[model samples]
Target: MSHAGDGAEVVLRLDRISKSFGALKANDAVSLTLRRGEVVALLGENGAGKTTLMNILFGHYLADDGGVEVFGQPLPPGNPRAALAAGVGMVHQHFTLAGNLTVLENIRLGTEGLWSRGAADARAKVERLSRDFGLAVHPDAKVGRLTVGERQRVEILKALYRDARILILDEPTAVLTPQESEALFATLRKATALGLSMIFISHKLHEVMAIADRCVVLRHGRVVGEVDTHATDKGALAALMVGGELSLPRAEVRVPGAVLMRLDGVSTPNRGAGPGLKAVTLELKAGQITGLAGVSGNGQAALAEIVGGLALPVSGSIMLKGEVVTGWSPGAALAKGVARIPEDRHHQGSIADFDLTENAVLEGYRSRFSRRGWMNWRAARAFAEGIIKDYDVRCPGPETRIRLLSGGNMQKLILGRVLSAGPEVILANQPVRGLDVGAIAYVQSQLIAARDRGAAVLLISEDLDEIMGLSDVIHVMSQGRLSPAFARGTMTAAELGLWMAGQKFEAPDAA
Candidate 1:
């Protein structure tokens, strides 16, 4: 019961699927098919309903209309257990493992067993899979202590433990280092060799081109085009996904002005299992975007927290506009004109249950949205309305619960709120993490605009293309210590990659 496709054998199919939440049409008659032993890249912009479609397929949500079939058999709507039993598994953007538990324990969970230390069997299976797929994860290590890449491997292993023949990955490369992403791709290739099918979702076209055997693109909640990866290039896919040539204009470098923010001898405790940052000294200049590029969990999170005033540095002096704010709280930092778009939008940026108006006023409610320590509903609503319009956030006015919006829209809201504050220094960590093509471009443009407006921008991201595209100067961090600053024209991807792996290479001084 395979989908009637040209060459490859179809193992899963979505037929005339449609889903809507009130006025918003999340998926509209979308149809796609996954082939056995083939990697299908699901491409789309942030709000194109790629994730939603995947969710529906995985039984996270029931489609309002239409039906799904696996191997030519009808599927029950909104039944995850049925989907899993039918050999479907998913690795989500946010990990779902219990952090404190051992990898074996995490993988063995949900199994019907009482006496079987299943831990032993799971560990053996994990080791075998790791060797076969090139995923490097310590099976005995506590999930809490693993790096982001390692944690991702655990997620994949968890799915494999369920014997998922068709695995769905949502933005798998967003949190990975270059080396880690390449390794994962190698694993995918290996998995394909073993007759496993995959549905890989990503915004990066290069990845799709490199790994996928076929590509299915979505736009405005519909299947716009499907192409053979071998026959198409990134430009063609980008055009399909974005509806235009992707324009990434380099930001003109303004000579960095006075030191707007400075961190001297900052030695923070290691937040992850990796080494702590040494006495790192760096300066953020006014009217410049300083890119902190590294694989995730290499102290980038800690650095952002320390700079944003969320975490006090164990040993350092943080001077913002010449005033020492070494131990200032987030509120104090905001008052002093430091705006930050946190990495984890769900955890730090916005409260899911809160309405747009409330979330918009989260950071600077005291001054912009309120006065005399009293809530000003009228002022806040007006301000929220302006941000929604200006930032192009699609929502049901300011009263909509932020959780209801898509990941891309939620990010837009955070960026809008941060930009509206008119802060002097902005700390953005993975600012465009889950956004779509257009949204990524928009966010990059907004960062450049902020820089042009004389705001010192600290851009922390694992995305090398983004760093190379938008940064005036690149600073690569490895094991919590930053390399010598690389002027925009001096560093190459290979050079940055080497530095990120702790290779001692001097950056050419002249740009």
Candidate 2:
């Protein structure tokens, strides 16, 4: 398909866009343009102003000293309705769909009047779009009942239903499996064929290389470099984004020690309609990373929660350090030297409204930062300050709220808080999700360092590459059941994929 070139019509333009939150300038006089049928990749480290620029274009945040033009028409500042009316659509990294609503209802929401007589027409259009773009999701399905990939498809369909000519996708494949990501890319290609222009924001250099026609690099909230996709390589793009050579950390060979944590035939009840852990047996040994690979909602969260002490199995036993555990809880897990890096950093990992000092002590405040009935403010602040400095968290100070820091920095603080305690067992759930290349390397290196220090690490991720790369032993989860562990390099991705699809599993035992 023909894409952005010198002669193509410009569909969207951001001229000298600038935005600041208090003292931080998120977007510093940034300018960008999108042409008809073009896929422009917006590449940057976390907090490098990629999201800020897109938000300005979509009218989520008004530009301090610039403007946006969609289809040669000036868009009204700070008005999402105006942007939508002008054919601009955005699918944020975190979806904005109501869980209780149906797919059709979410697509039709805010676009039509209440009690409008266009229900049938909307359903028909949705079906057609789903068929044409390969976004296969039932229109009548409740959104909360859908998988992560299906939800993402619904988000895309929502934008298409609004006749969006220009689309902005932020970290679109962050939660998707390899197979699902490929499908999404196929849909994007189809969209481009239909003359839709897209601004693709992603931290995965390979995805940008595969899908984007051009790459626009942002650093410190300014346009640093722009390159044609065909002419540049991933390494070059990585350097452009981070302003240096990038090297991802690799897992080193180490003999695994004794089992630090084990779950034997564990079963937990379903979460809503989702499957829970069922007869799953797993072992985490010291000095090794045991990777769990699966599609989203396939008992990965259940397993992580069980290990992290968020939930206990309804049946079977949990053994920590070869001892049968009782009364397991977050504090209990911490006391037993289990450090958890939760999947959802914004919600589970750190509180949004709390300052860095407060969040730094969240998991250990009662035991470590408290004496008798009183709190140690000075010790807490010192600990918070230590994390900020040691972990390279770039923020104003310990007094700054965690919500104000970038995803990478926020993750760094979490890493510091947990690692500082010198845990013997580490539960890292999607540890590097949505992080830039630099941040990903840092986080992975830290995990490796922990493993080197004889920490038994349980790494859960949807990305097959990450699983294969970091895992000493790999297990695939499907239908809440765990497959037999395969040593690293013993199973190909396709073989593991079959396990993920539940094709290789034996029938469940009669209840």
Candidate 3:
């Protein structure tokens, strides 16, 4: 049921907002409204202009035509300070917290002088807010030392601390666990009860159905459908976002072959807040998808790095095709027919300043796209063009800097770059983290096709549903330790959750 009544005051409005970059129109005459104490979900496929429109609303971008009104006042174009002064707050998908700063410091950074007498009052208010909202993060904890879920809480607290009446959240739960997501939903309910309005942008339909009072769908940069939450279902919403019925690919029953890659009793040093792999013995079998599920910061990163050849195990041997490998590096991994899809696409997967053509050949340039001493720009461009067509990446051209593309399109480019190489093994790490439903289906289908082609695939994700749906065998990680592999249909989600929480593991022997 919606908290806001029909008679409730309208707190925010967007009227005929139109924005374009080059020939691509990011937003086209888009219009929306938010009532006090209401939650409106903005739904769309990637590149459908969801983020662009939100950016415009938050004053990160200026509309070519039309404007935004906050509580009946016209917000100045492209002035973030104006947006803030108007009590508008935005929490980005990728966090904006500084690593070296404390949570209290991050929240109070621009609001007031750090050494002022108001600092003590701010601390007391933060503690009160945290308790009232069920956002239980330590005020003095360093941001870099916090988990993904904790950092998200800080982001929300930052907005509430500024006395924001309207909050915009972009993919807020992408990295959060199911429990954390439920907690966030509860917090939103509390916020709305106190007369705050919000705009939630998400690809997860179930979440939209649960938390949003109304849903607005965008397609091809324009509003196509709007419906009350009580009137619409998840399937209908999915259809509205993509313009038709959506069919996600399923993993078919299959028998896997020999172990293609194996890690025997691997151990590594701890990094930052996350522990290293602890005597973890694992295998990626030919023609199989090995799924790893865990809470964030539970040694998943170290495991991915090991397989991607970015790190070496301090102990234990890495075997490839029945032979122990040495001198392992990214180049070595590629030479051995291993393709890595990194967790952070913007940082590890591709360079922001590089064009599509340059990123397509980043991993294979030395051996495939380049000769003894020179680069083949013509061949590289053709390869990039082929990937764009084959993977259905939406972009103007290969020469366009990859930073300009939406998250889903960027991921498609990365997938195309790796899969096109015809590798024997694949490392897909959180492959569809922030993508729309369509993109998730496409990426998963590609991995299944690769498995059918006899490639050993390792899928690491924080999403248990995706893991259970796609993997032939599953493993859970907790505190740098790996659980025994369970077949796809053998273990229930509850059973996996036990493992994920470290309740199912035996105590490690003293070293």
Best by lDDT: 3
| Clash list (residue pairs), candidate 1 | 46-436
Per-model C-alpha RMSD: 3.9, 2.7, 2.9
Model 2 quality (TM-score): 0.92
Ranking under TM-score, best-scoring first? 2, 3, 1
For model 1, how does the per-residue alpha-carbon lDDT over 106-191 read when each residue is reduced to its tens digit? 88878645247755666788899888777777878999888777889989988888889899988898877777787788788888
Task: Candidate 1: list runs displaced more than 4 Å.
Answer: 1-5, 98-103, 112-114, 117-128, 136-145, 270-276, 322-327, 368-380, 502-511
lDDT of 2 by residue, 35-91 (tens): 999999999988798878877877778788998999999999999899999999889
After TM-score superposition, the amount by which residue 376's alpha carbon in candidate 3 deviates from its true location, in angstroms, is 5.8
Cα error of candidate 2 at position 314, Å? 1.4
lDDT of 3 by residue, 322-440 (tens): 99999999899999999999999999999999999999999888898778789999999999999999999989999999999889899999999999989999999999988888899
Model 3 pairs whose backbones collide: none
Better of 1 and 2 by lDDT: 2
Superposing every Cα of model 2 onto the true structure, what RMSD results? 2.7
lDDT of 3: 0.91
